[model samples]
Target: MADEYRPEFIRRKFTITESLDEVLKQMADRYYQGNVSLCLRASIESYREILEGEGYMATRRIERQLENLVDEQRTLLMEITSVRSGLQESHRESADGQQLTEPSMTNEMVRIIELLKTTGDGLEFGDLVEQLDLGMHKVQPALGRLVDRGVVTRTGEDGERFTLAGFSQHYLRSGP
Candidate 1:
C-alpha cells in the first residue's frame, strides 16, 4: 500500500560562470563524449570534499544548539512539576486544617444544614423553599450565602439543586 505512490524525478539546473563552462566543455570533449549531464555531475562531484566539510561543521554546531535547548526545556519542566507538587502538598495540609476550624453557621444555614442532613440524596431549590415554608427571595439569597461559605454546593444540570458540600461529593457524583 505504501509503495503505490512513486516520487517524480526532478532535474535541477545549475548555471556556471564562463570560466567554469569553458573548463567543463574542455573536460567533456576530452573524456565524456559531449554529454553535458555527465560533465555536470562529474563537475559537481569534484566539489564534494570542500562542500561536505563545511556542511559537517554547520550540522555539528546546530546539533549542539538543539541539545542546549532540549536541556533547558527539561529543566523548565522539572521546575514546573516541583512547584505543582509543593502547591498540592500545601493545599492538602490547608484542607485538613479547615476541617479542624469550623466557621459559625447562620440561623438559615443551620436550618438548611439540618434539612440537607435529613434528606439522603439532595434537595432542589423549590423543594427547599416549600419544605422550609420560605419565599423564593429569602431562600435564594440564603443558599447563595451558604454556597459562598462553602457549607453547601449547587448541583444538578441547571444547578437548581443544593446539598451539603462535603456530602455532595458522594451523592452528586453522577449528576451536576
Candidate 2:
C-alpha cells in the first residue's frame, strides 16, 4: 500500500521586523503552544479570505480600509464622549456602594475599551495609535489606567498586545 493522502506545505523564508518576529514567537507560545507553523498558518488563512475574496480588488481594499478607519474613529469618539459624561455624574453617586468604590471610565479608557470591543482578536500599542487617532502621549496613561484597574490586559515582550479583561489569555500577533 502507498501512502496517498498527505498535505504538502509551502516553505519560504520571510523577513519580518524584529518586533514582529518577537510577537509571532509570543503568539505561538501562548495561543498555539509553541507551534509556530500552526500559528503562522492560522494567521495567513484568516487574512487570506479578505485579500483573496471574490469581487475584491486592491483599490477596493484600500478604500475599505480607509472607510473602516473613519467609521471606527467616529463611533469611538461618539461613544467615549457619551459614556464619559454619562458616567462622570453617576459613578460616585450610585445608589449602591459598589460602583462608588470603582473609578469611572474616562474618555480615554472608554475609547480604548470600545475599540477593543470591535477588534477580531487584540491590538498592540502601535495598532491603538493608528486606529484611535490618539498619540502615544494620550494612549499611554489611559492604557495604564485600564490595565491597572484590571479592565484590560497587556502581554508580550513589551506589552505588545491589549485585549479586554476576560480575553487576557487570547493572542494573535496583533498587527498587520
Top lDDT: which candidate number? 2
Local distance difference test, per candidate?
0.72, 0.76
Residues 19-44, model 2: lDDT tens digits: 99899999999999999899999898
Q: Quote model 1's TM-score.
A: 0.37
Write down the lDDT that model 1 would get: 0.72
Candidate 1: how many backbone clashes? 0
Model 1 agreement with the true structure over 1-176: per-residue lDDT tens digits: 56787657469977879998888788898889987678877767666744878657777889999999999999999999999997555434233223212345556666776677666567998899999888888888888888887767877888878877775334333433
Query: Candidate 2, which ten residues in sequence have the lowest lDDT sum?
Result: 93-102
Output the lDDT of residue 23, model 1: 84
lDDT of 2 at 102: 41
- lDDT of candidate 1 at residue 82, scale 0 to 100: 100
Model 2 stretches astray by more than 4 angstroms: 1-103, 156-158, 167-176
Candidate 2 lDDT: 0.76
